[model samples]
Target: MNEIDILKKIASNLTERKSTAALSNYEVLCNNIAFSHDLFEKGIVYLEFIIDHLKSIFNDRLSLKGDFRENECLHPFISVIPSLLLNDLEVIKKLSAYTPPDNRHGITIDNVSLLHRGFMNYNNLATATRQLIDSLVTDSYQLQLLDPKEFNYHVLLSLNSFEKYATKSIRQGLFNQEIEDALLEFRKLNFKDWKNSSITKCQHITFSNKVDHLFTNLNLVASEDIKFKNEINNLFKFSSEFTHIGYISTFFTSQAGSQVVFGSEKSPYLPSTENFSELKYQILETCINFIHKVYLPSLSSCVSKIFSSSQELVIEKHISNLVSLLKEGIKTRNNSYYFFVCSSLIGSQRIIDLPCLCGHLNKWRPPHSNSDLFCTGCGSSYNILAIEGDPGYIITGNGPVKVIGSEAPDFQDLPKEKQQEMLIKVAEFNANGSGN
Candidate 1:
């Protein structure tokens, strides 16, 4: 059956017998799906923001006066976001297909298999979310701090560090002799003295290193809070279980009352189903906070650092939306959710039907100061550019949606520099023919 039909079939049966846990799998799945569903929307905006800002930076710097390393540094980030997003959507889909063990069958072998798959998917989701955290916070730190050559080299070393694992893997005949010979040849060809090169011995700057350097690079108030590091470390520790174990999260589309089957380890006391929902929510909340409290500030600083030589605001125009969103988030986070309606008290509202990309009319009144304009229809809010006589325009991140798969091939699959070459080719082709 098709995925939607399968999901419908699965979700159409959440009703339960008396033997299940305190919360029925139906209710537990509902809460988790609802949480992840909301997160999916937030995650999209967050990823889009990153890609959009990256687009601004890439397009602006792609034509720089000198050095190919600038583009090289950017290449890793291009594929990573799209890949994570694909995983995110998939996790939610799998979760939607979730159902608890049918106690009516007394936890049969089939039910055990079902539960095992559910938890496994949950772990995968956790790991993917953790990876997303790095893409947003840790990766942004590198972009804003390191020079292009240094950053690109770090990524290269990380990607090409198969030598160490292979050479000393301790797994008997992990690689065939032919592959072994190829690896040796590859290292010899690339690194003249693979055995003695100091650069080869050096470790890439890790997420913790990036976090450590975040404050040193920029003097933000949260720099001294110490909680960002603690939270991120804790998040990694939690996801490490799932990342290695390969278990995990789910899709949001489900009907109430579906009988679900899940596997669990035998224990003195079974853990409550509520725990996963809370944990997933907490991780996502932490991700959002890191983006706002850490990445955005670091990114703004990076933009200035990067364009320090230029006089005009080449990339800031595109990035200002992110800063604006951060500002709005900080402004309203502590206050009431309905404070925006109260905002109309202080500033006059403009009734314009400037169409939003969400297919909703943007007739809502914006703040008099032209800060961030939030579309009520799609809830996609960003900084509204207030130009004279131009009723302001929406700069939807407008980053390439299919950069990895359909447009230029997956960046991860490409060899060093080939992704960049293919990307430019795709850009050129799309530019000439209007991306038909």
Candidate 2:
């Protein structure tokens, strides 16, 4: 039948159920397409920022592996984002970001194999998922359009198979020997009797469930986006049975269920937190989760070598912000969480310029020795050592000025009485502005 005949048949079928004409299942699916791009764009902004942050820190230190540059951490992110073409995804660089050291280096916190393993897992999963999505859009759409009279149900079968494939790979990716060995044994049987097995009793879990499992294993957790969770669960159920459509004449007429609504009722003109696609959000979050579990902690490990309470707090807060951003999206941006690095983590030494009058600064010589101090603001030099007994007070044109500088070794080694005598002399110099 032509398009008009198809519409008439849909209308006739809906009328029989006493329902108004509604979007077919495929229409609902198509309407949700915008969810993918908008959400992925926002997600990429954060991912790029994160990659840049890692590059700024570890890129210089990583070793080049083959043609893959040591510092290039964008491979995984690029692998996921929408691609024009990706035929060779299987052979793509998945471990380039994880080059090992040249020598037999002991695996310290700074060089944890798990950290690199996290990146490799992330890259590999994204590669597989991207390829599957490409097939979903290209092959699935083509198969569906071959003829309305005979759309391929096998495409939907492949879709079901691919989701389960991803779910299984994710389970294996955990790298837990116990879990791996158990899953390995199960796979050997082709999961023929998996339903009777102790581990899950044959129930298939959604992506969010796998993520939760990962977090539980790692002793870290993130809040789930309920809508995202539901969408993924629902998506897997879209075509659960391979023989479903063969028995239903309504399959072509109702792509999704009849009661389902497509798109949103909200006005587009208003500024709102962009709604991300469930698939895109999870994919993006997977990348962020890897960073959270491995990259940030590795950075923290390197940073903690130096003892600084403020720096530690700052870095921890930074890590927390990143996790929140990934889970909550731009909602976490209100507090400037997107910054790659914060100044507080730098723990820089603060210096007061000492207000030079002629824009000139030079080390002043004391009669006793060269203090290597540069505190003179006026044309005449002041006896700064007078403040050793009291760094809290310095005599000057502005009366008493408190000056604290890094300890002057020469002055620190002097006798207390001598220092006091010098203080008295400085007091006299302040009183006359000429007596040293």
Candidate 3:
């Protein structure tokens, strides 16, 4: 129907349902649509940023419109975001809101409960999608200022999270019916059937067989978006590089030297401004194409399938506010990420036993030697070493020991008196085998 007619129908429907719970259902459905729309807005901001960044880089280089070198840099984020967004939309579609037209066809308690389950799945997908969009924004900024190659690693991790949620949603949808059927099969039994046991077994067997049939038919329920499906298939193939060693792995690794060359001697590897401009062009093209052709449809389809035209009109009333809130949220959440890696030699470390305050011997180890050295016996957070008495070293059998590991804090790091006090306590503990 035309826009005017659709609005009229929506108005009529709302007036007709003024006193009915369908109005409330429509309201709730609009909220869910708004929530998904908020994520879409955030994602759009990232895409626009990438597009703008590309324009700035390539605006001066019209001569290099079609250069293809270094295009690999743009591939990960380009394919990853759209694929993940499409998957998220599909999960949302599974929970399409239902409002029966008449009393005879109204939603049942079971349907309401099932819808709740679907909402839970959609909520998880939405959160994970937001995290990915946030990561992409952060990565995009970092790419400009730091290592551009790090973008792929961040995208790969986000893809892992997105895939994890998508798999969970699929499993939840797939097994929900089987679980209900299994319960129904159990309920349809008498005392005699229970005593027979074989009847119960047969029921379970039938349910198992049906599950197999459902698995075979699952492909029929797959997303109708061919590009989405193709992207998902391609994504899964390339995602393995993050988990295993291969070519994509090398994309993030530092080169041996700037002088290293590849391919022909005549062409001897050198960075060109044209190639860089082409890379920017590729980024721009991919982001624009995906945003228009893939992301917009996916978001529109999600909202379209879940809400009626009347409810959509209601959502439109708040679209401006949603967009503003999305912008505020993105601005607040745009912060740099700091991460640390442990490269110390873990093999040479000795597992020192220390007494816990709780009178357990397995509790404390010196700081930073092993983070995982919690007490398994007493469940204490760490092993506590209790040192008592005068500020002098109590001699061990072989010698006076001040510290254990070289990585341990320097004795001079503490005040001279405090260092002597700690050493005396350690020596006392060594001599008596107990501080308390």
Residue 358 in model 2: shift from native, Å? Answer: 62
- Global fold similarity of model 1 (TM-score): 0.45
Candidate 1 per-residue lDDT over residues 1-436, each given as its tens digit? 8999987855554332223343433333333344334333433444354444444544455433343225554444444434433444444344323322212234454443332223554665676765666556545665565454454444445445754665455434555675455455445644644423533322235667666677556554364457667778678767766666632222211212333344433211122333344455465556656655666566566555444345226445434443444333333332221111222233455454444433345554545444435666546664432223321111112111221112334333545344333333333333243331
Between prediction 1 and prediction 3, the one with superior TM-score is 1
lDDT tens digits, residues 113-201, model 2? 22121222323434444433333323222211222111222222333355465765674564457534544554554345434443324
lDDT of 3 by residue, 169-284 (tens): 67566456644464455446563554234223222122223222322322323454445434433432343343344443343332222221222211222222122223222222
Candidate 3 is scored at a TM of: 0.21
* Poorest 10 consecutive residues by lDDT, candidate 1: 396-405
Runs off by more than 4 Å, candidate 2: 1-18, 21-40, 52-59, 62-209, 218-232, 239-322, 326-436
Winner by lDDT: 1
Q: What is the lDDT of residue 114 in candidate 2?
A: 24
How far residue 358's Cα lies from its native spot in candidate 1, in Å, is 26
lDDT of 1: 0.44
lDDT values for all models = 0.44, 0.33, 0.33
Cα displacement (Å) at residue 342, model 3: 57
lDDT of residue 317 for candidate 1: 41
In angstroms, the error of model 2 at 119 is 36
